[model samples]
Target: MKVLVPVKRVVDYNVKVRVKADETDVDLANVKMSMNPFDEIAVEEAVRLKEKGIVTEVVAVTCGLAACQDTLRSAMAMGADRGILIESSIELQPLAVAKLLKSICEMEAPSMVICGKQAIDDDSNQTGQMLAALLDWPQATFASKVELAGDKIIVTREIDGGLETLSMALPAVVTTDLRLNEPRYATLPNIMKAKKKPLDTIAAESLGVDTAPRLKTIKVSEPPRRAGGVKVADVADLLNKLRNEAKVI
Candidate 1:
């Protein structure tokens, strides 16, 4: 089976994101960018499947500007056979991305597709589901564990209360969650070898998908700073304050 893993480049999780002075969007001028953490788990899972001989090939795909090639290279370093980049400068919505991935799926004909449950930047959590809907495939989101059983896959998903397991037939979509697996670091030798790995870039427009924004962001701003807590003289004072000022009572 051939596995396709989709990745996204976003502001590094450790870095503090700032809103632009004009409030148009988040400032990215000098921000450090890296692959989304959840996507790393997806790549690791695919590579593990390949290592186990369950999958023959792992193809990494990313959709975005030219810079996304770097993200694809990171995946290649981790053990993907090759990469495909859908180049576009426009910000693609979840639907647009799913449509583009659908096109790539038709071309690649992978046995399964895996990606992050949600991109950190947007937290939309819609792409994988949309892609499955587009391709008319079964989907398992927030996957913590996956087992290949003959022609079917059993996935353990993280839900609100606990884990839920489901079995789906082949050619399914799986979205990885944080606890799925720890991603391995790309070694220096593998990083060097990644340069030689085949990475083909195709224009997103050539996919014939409308990469337009369905939603508009009026402005981006920092969350309000939390107010300092007050020290009460006793439980009665606390109750009084909570009942009066806080009005919880």
Candidate 2:
């Protein structure tokens, strides 16, 4: 089976975030960036499938600025055969991203596509589902486990009530959950090897799709800082405050 995995670049989770001066977006300048945590999980799952001989080839793809090439290389270091970078300086909404990915799907023609349930920065859980819809293919979202058998895919998903299993035919899309697998770090040797791997760069315009920004960010602001609480001498004092000032009791 040929597997296609889509990865993303986002601010490293450990770094402290600051809102930009204009309050339009977070400050990315001089900040350390890494692959989205959820995307890393998807890449790990895809690599495992290839390592186990279940997948014949794995291709990692990403859509973003040139800086995102680093994240794609990370995916290659993790075991993807090659990488494709769809260069786009402008931020793409979920629908636009899905459309571009659909074009890539047509070119790659892989049996399966894997992606994170959502990107960390935006937390928009729409790309995978949208891509599936555009392709008119089956989708297994929030997948905790995935198994392939005779052109069929068995997916175990985590739902609100409990786990649910479903089966879908080949040529499907699967969005991975956090518990799916532990992402491996890129070793030094693999990192060097990744530098030599083939990376295909394509412009978004070449895909013949409108790359316009569909959504507008009217405003951005920081969440209000939490207020400090006063200490109460006794339960009666607390009760008094709750009953009168706070008005809870």
Candidate 3:
């Protein structure tokens, strides 16, 4: 069975983001870029599946500028057999990304697709579901554990209240959560091997997916600074302040 994993290139989580002076978007010039942390978990999960002999091939795909090839290379270094890059300089929203991925899915025809529950950059948490909808396949989101049995896959997902378990047929979509698996760092040898791995680049437009922005960004700005907490001398003072100064009784 072949598994497809998709990753996104974003500003490194550790880096502090700054809004551009013109309020257009986050300033990315000369900033550190890396793979989305959640997507790393997805790649790790796919690699683990391949290591367990449950999957024959793990293919990693990313859609973005030419720089996104680096993110795909990271997936290959983590044990993906090959990499596919849908090249586009423009930033794609979740829906457009799902559409492009749907096109790739039709061409690759993998047994399943693995993705991060959400990308940290957008935090939309919509691509996997959208892709599953577009593909008309079963979807398991926020999967913490996954097991393969025959033609079906059992997934344990993290929900609001507690863990929920579900079994879905093959050719499903699984989105990784935080506890899915800890991503392993690529060793020097593996990194070298990844350089030789087959990586094919395709123009996003060739997929025939409309890559237009349906939503417009009115403005991007930094959040308001939080006010400092105030201290009260006693319960009486606090009550007095709450009733009079704070106007909340």
Candidate 4:
């Protein structure tokens, strides 16, 4: 079976995101860019499936500017058989990306899709579900554990109430959450080999999927600085603060 994994490029997790000076968007000028952490986990899971011989091929695809090829290379280094890049000049929103992935899905015909539950940049957490809805495929979101049983895919997901297990047939979509699997660093040899792997870049417009941004960002700004905490003198003082100052009581 073939599994398609969608990876995204975003600011490295360690970086402190800064809003643009004009309050238009996050400052990307000379910012450190890397694969989305959740997407990294998804790639790791797909690679593991391939290693287990459960998946014949693991194809990594991404939709973004030319720089996103680096993200795809990272996926290939992690064991994706090949990479597909849908290059777009404009910033892609979740719905647009889902539509593009749907187009690619029609073209690739992969039996399953694995993707990050959310992108750290936006934290929208909507792509996988949107893709599943667009494709009319069974979907399991926030999957912590995934297993293959014959023609079915079993996924254990996290919920506020606890874990939820779901079983879906072939041709499904699963989104990775934290604790799914730790991503493996690409060894130097694999990193070098990834350069030689087949990577095809397609213009996003050629897919006939509208790549327009439907939502507009009114402004972007950093959150207010957190206030320092105060120490209470005793239980009475704590209760007094909670009732009078903090207002919780």
TM-score of each: 0.95, 0.94, 0.94, 0.96
Question: Which residue runs of candidate 3 sit more than 4 Å off their true CA positions?
Answer: 232-249
> What lDDT does candidate 1 reach at residue 227?
93
**Tens-digit lDDT string for candidate 4 (6-116):** 999999999999888899999888999999999999999999988998899999999999999999999999999999999998989999999999999999999999999
In the range 89-120, model 3's lDDT, one tens digit per residue, is 88799999999999999999999999999999
lDDT rank order: 1, 4, 3, 2
Candidate 1, residues 1-249: lDDT per residue as tens digits? Answer: 999999999999999999989999999998999999999999999999999999999999999999999999999999999999999999899999999999999999999999999999999999999999999999999999999999999999999999999999999999999999999999999999999999999999888898899999998889999999889999999999999999999
- Model 2 clash pairs are none
lDDT of each: 0.96, 0.94, 0.95, 0.95
TM-score of 4: 0.96
In model 4, the runs with Cα more than 4 Å from the true position are none
Off by over 4 Å in 2: 233-244
lDDT of 3 at 248: 87
- For 37-106, candidate 2 gives per-residue lDDT tens digits of 9999999999999988999989999999998899999999999999999999888888888999999999
**Whole-model lDDT for model 2 versus the true structure?**
0.94
Worst ten in a row by lDDT for model 2: 213-222
